[model samples]
Target: MATRLELALLSARGVGKGIRLLEYVGLVIVLAATLLAGGHEVWRMFSSGKVGISDLLLLFMYLEMVSMVETYWRMGKLPVRMPLYIAMVGIARHLMADSSYHDPWLMIAGAGAIVLLAVGVFIVRYGHLRFPYTQASEEATDRE
Candidate 1:
């Protein structure tokens, strides 16, 4: 039984190592892709001579995505609000860029959705700051 437990522990450690390796590889790939995409967008912005607020907003979204990836790589976790904030920016950009092409009602609905998502992100961020969670290792011991 002890040998079996040892083997299981070894397997778990091996799997954890494998996962960490894979995560690092994935992070590298994502970072490279993000840089390439950002460069392309900047080139387009300079060449087109038609950059607008929406273009800037899209760039901000890309920046946020890269930041989120870096944050996860550094901390092994991502803030839940990051992606939500990105999504809100993306939706706002889409609406601003193509508002005239869609029905007014649809535009209103999309804007409303963006507002709701932004509010949710704000609430989550506030809650997290106000009431941070205890680390799992810290929780293992009771305070005197």
Candidate 2:
């Protein structure tokens, strides 16, 4: 026979496990979709007579997304810089693929976004290096 506190804890643990399972399932779906899209792009590039800059850029974005997901799956934690790097690459791709020489302002805005993401990556790196956590916290996290 368990006390009310014990029962509540058990319930909480069950819910936590359920949520984690759902997260893994979601990640698997994302991985599958990314892989399919990437494979399609590669096949199309091969089948077509020419591969344009935009096509390569789109493929690169897909690859970066897959990398981010794989890193998260392996590390059990996602780094703040991964998405920033992706965003920077995405912005660059957009600027190169969709820019018109007539509209300098649009190009400037995309370039600005790249710069902002770069700064964010720098900040995240500095914070992690400057305020490193103790081994105790690492051990506790591993137990979880």
Candidate 3:
């Protein structure tokens, strides 16, 4: 027979396992979707016989998504900058594909957003380098 504390710990462990399982399932779904989208994009380009810059950028975004998922799956952690990089790519793609040249303010806003995201990525990388996380904190962060 286990003590109350032991039972509680066991329950917590089970919950943790369930959460991790869900995480894995979610990752798989995301990976599958990304791959499917990328393949469709490639097929579209081949069928049309024209690969535009926007199409390439869209593919690149898919690749980044795949890489982000892979990194998280393998490392059990995610760098904060990965999503920022993806966002920057997405914004650039949008700006290129649907250039709002007539609306100079909108174009400026999109460019500003990319610049802000880049700055965020730089700050995160710099922080990780200058004030690296300790083993314990990193593990804590992974748990969260």
Query: What's each prediction's TM-score?
Result: 0.85, 0.87, 0.93
Give a tens-digit lDDT track for model 3, residues 1-144: 899999999999999999889999999999999999999999999999999988998998899999999999998778889889889988888888785643889889999999999999889989989998899997897667
Q: lDDT for model 1, on a 0 to 1 scale? A: 0.86
- 2 against 3, candidate with superior TM-score: 3
lDDT of 1 by residue, 1-144 (tens): 469889998998898889889998998898888889888999999999888998899889889988998999998777899989998988888888885738888898888998899899889989989987778644663221
- Using lDDT as the measure, the top candidate is 3
Task: For model 3, state the Cα shift of residue 137 in Å.
Answer: 2.2
Model 2 lDDT per residue over 9-80, tens place: 999889989987887898899999999999998998889877988788888889888998898788777888
**Candidate 2 accuracy as TM-score:** 0.87
Number of the top-ranking candidate, with TM-score as the measure: 3
Local error of candidate 2 at residue 44 (angstroms): 1.6
